[model samples]
Target: MPARNEAGNLPALVDEIAAALASRGPFEAIVVDDGSNDATPKVLAELKRTRPWLIPLRHAVSCGQSAAIRTGVRAATAPVVATLDGDGQNDPTFLPAALDALAAGGARVGLVAGQRLGRKDTGFKKIQSRIANAVRGRVLGDGTRDTGCGLKAFRRDVFLALPYFDALHRFLPALVRREGFEVGLIDVVDRPRQAGVSNYGLWDRLWVGILDLYGVWWLIRRRRQVPEVTEL
Candidate 1:
């Protein structure tokens, strides 16, 4: 989890996710501090002291969400990696379901993305996301309905193969598909933010997404195509 200025939500979010993971099976949570200017560091330190599973990585300067995610993934010790928004909107209970989907879908499924069934966000934000998803689906042809949904899981190697960018987190399905791996989507419930404020607004994300979409499109066009080779 890449957390920034989430002091109010960190404690509950950490506890709930930890309990949920414990209920299903064994898992570890890595809390990456993206240079938070709030009490998030103190809260994370406290949680780490109490919970052995929690690994905390602190950034001296804010490097945005994508960088934080990359840092966390690199520090992960598990073969399978899962990510959830630190804003407390994503339910950690659905993690098992995502894992099961990947297992049932087989090894070809490189990434399992969660599609938020019922989102709890402001009207403008929802509308913007719908527009972005539609445009992205048409262009990327990734067959993913909700790319912005934060809850997702994938093989560590598959994730490492993708080209990392500033907003690559939002277009993970497309990136995974580029590596000739299948992408799976599962419906996950979204909840209202438990505490703190959302850092993103409609316009900010919309403009940034438009630029990123074009960049990804160019990457797809330039993708190398090679024929299969067999060894004797």
Candidate 2:
């Protein structure tokens, strides 16, 4: 999980995750604290002492959520990586199902993104997301409904191979497709923030994404289509 000052929500979210997937298999939680000014690091330390499966990684200064996720995925030993926001809005109850879906989809499926069914964001925030998603879908043709959903499961190697960027997380469906892999989708009921303030809002998110949308579109068009090779 990529966290920035999410101390208030971590404890309960951690417990929920443990309860949800403890029996499934050997799974680990890598909480990347992105230079939080709150008690996030200390809280992670305390949790680590008790939870062996919890891996706590920290950033000296905030490097944004995408960098934090990349750091955690790089440090992970698991074949598949699951990431959710640290603010407790992503319900841990849906993780096992996502893992199962990814597993069943087999190797060709590089990403299984959670589509938020009922968003709990403010009206303006939802509107911004709707506009963004509509534009992205029309441009990229990624066939994903809710790319903004934090709950996502993907192969570790696939994620590592994809081009990394500051806002790359929101473009996974398109990038994974660019890597010759199919994307899977699952519907998850959105939950309201359990605690702490939201780090994102309308204008801050919208303005930056306009350029990124076009950039991704360019990438799609410029891709070199590799022909099938047959060797003697």
Using TM-score as the measure, which candidate wins? 2
Q: Each prediction's TM-score against the native?
A: 0.95, 0.96
Give the clashing residue pairs of candidate 2, or none.
none
Per-residue lDDT tens digits of candidate 2, residues 67-89?
Answer: 99999999999899999999988
Query: How many clashing pairs does model 1 include?
Result: 0
Candidate 1: C-alpha lDDT: 0.89
Model 2 lDDT at residue 10:
96
- Clashes (backbone N, CA, C under 3 Å), per candidate, total 0, 0
How much is 109 displaced in model 2, in angstroms? 0.5
lDDT per model, in order?
0.89, 0.91
Model 1 deviation from the true structure expressed as Cα RMSD, one decimal place: 1.5
Badly placed stretches (over 4 Å) of model 2 are 226-232
Worst 10 residues of 2 by lDDT: 220-229
